[model samples]
Target: MTITIYGIKACDTMKKSFVWLDQHKVEWQFHDYKKAGTNKKDLQRWIKAFGWETVINRRGTSWRKLPEDTRASMDASGAISAALQNPSLIKRPIIEGNGILEIGFDPAHWAELF
Candidate 1:
């Protein structure tokens, strides 16, 4: 199975996810959002797969730091655009494989993959 995990390298959740994959002997690719930035097309795809509410990391500092107007004024597309421009706002450990995408790191949720 081919997998791609997206997040900042230093993020604890990302680190844990990577370690878990390694421990399971799963082969995967890492997309470091800090360096790579979020892609609009990919974000749109994820949003479609998981829904914007699940894909966007509103709990992160990046989302909190956004200006009141920007955050409050955002429609679905606007929020997605913001997330694409600032990956820190796009949650951690988003794993995709075989056209399936999972957001966040819940070992129970990932157990099926292994």
Candidate 2:
């Protein structure tokens, strides 16, 4: 399976994920949303696979920085729109491959998936 990891390159969690993947010799492509930008279709698919609540990084600074109204108005579609507009709003190190869509960085979870 072709693994594609999506996130900003400088994220600490993303760094850890990269190291883990490298240590495991997992061949994968890094999709830096900050540089390449996010695709609405892909984001929608991910949100569909793992609800907007799971795909969005509400704990992150990006989410916290959003206007109160924006945050309060968030629904599935709104969340997807926000994430597409600001890639940082999406959870880091979203790993996609082999019909799997894993969000965030959890070594234990990755161990099982890998």
Candidate 3:
């Protein structure tokens, strides 16, 4: 399976994920959203697969920085729109490959899935 890891290059979680993957000798591709931008179709697919609640990174600074009304008013569609507009709003290191889609970086979860 072709493994692809998506996230900003500088994220600490992303860095840890990369290190783990490297130590495990897993072949993968990195998709830097800052450089490549995010696709609506991919975002929608993530939302469909994992639910918007899982895909959206409410704990992140990007989400926290949003206006209160904006945060309060978010629905699935609104969340998707917001994520598309700001890639950082989506969870870090979304992994796609091997008929799997994962959000966030958890070594244990990755070990089981991969």
Candidate 4:
């Protein structure tokens, strides 16, 4: 199974996830949203698979820093746009296997897959 991990390299959770994958000898590809650029289609797919509430990182400081008006006006498109511009707004460690999607790192959750 091919796995694609989408997140910034600096995230601790992402680092841990990567380590776990490496230790398990899981072959995977890393896509840094900042350098790779997040597209609306992929964001939409993730939102559909995981729900916007699950994929959006509202707990992050980046989300907290957004203006109230901006936050209030965000619909699906707006949220995707925001996520594309500010990748931190996305939940870290979004992983996909083929077309199957998983958000965030929980060893147990991933263990079920392999």
The best candidate in terms of lDDT: 2
Task: Please give, for residues 1-114, the per-residue lDDT of candidate 1 as tens digits.
Answer: 879999999999888999898888888999999898878888888888788777878888888899999878876698688887788888788998886588899888788866
Pairs of residues clashing in candidate 3: none
lDDT on C-alpha atoms for all candidate structures:
0.85, 0.91, 0.90, 0.87
- Candidate 2 lDDT at 28 equals 88
TM-score, every prediction: 0.92, 0.95, 0.94, 0.93
Ordered from best to worst lDDT, the candidate numbers read 2, 3, 4, 1
lDDT of 1 at 34: 86
Locate the minimum summed-lDDT window of 10 residues in model 3. 97-106
Q: Name the lDDT of candidate 1.
A: 0.85
Clashing pairs in 2: none
In candidate 2, how many Å is residue 41 off?
A: 0.6
Tens digit of per-residue lDDT, candidate 3, span 20-65? 9999888899999898989989989999988988899989899999
- Candidate 2 per-residue C-alpha lDDT over 15-111 given as tens digits, one digit per residue, 9 for 90 to 100: 9999999998888899999999999898889888889989999999999999999999898999988988899998998998887788889998888
Point out where model 2 deviates above 4 Å: none
> What residue runs in model 1 are displaced by over 4 Å at the alpha carbon?
none
Number of clashes recorded per candidate: 0, 0, 0, 0
Alpha-carbon shift of residue 103 in model 3 (angstroms): 0.9
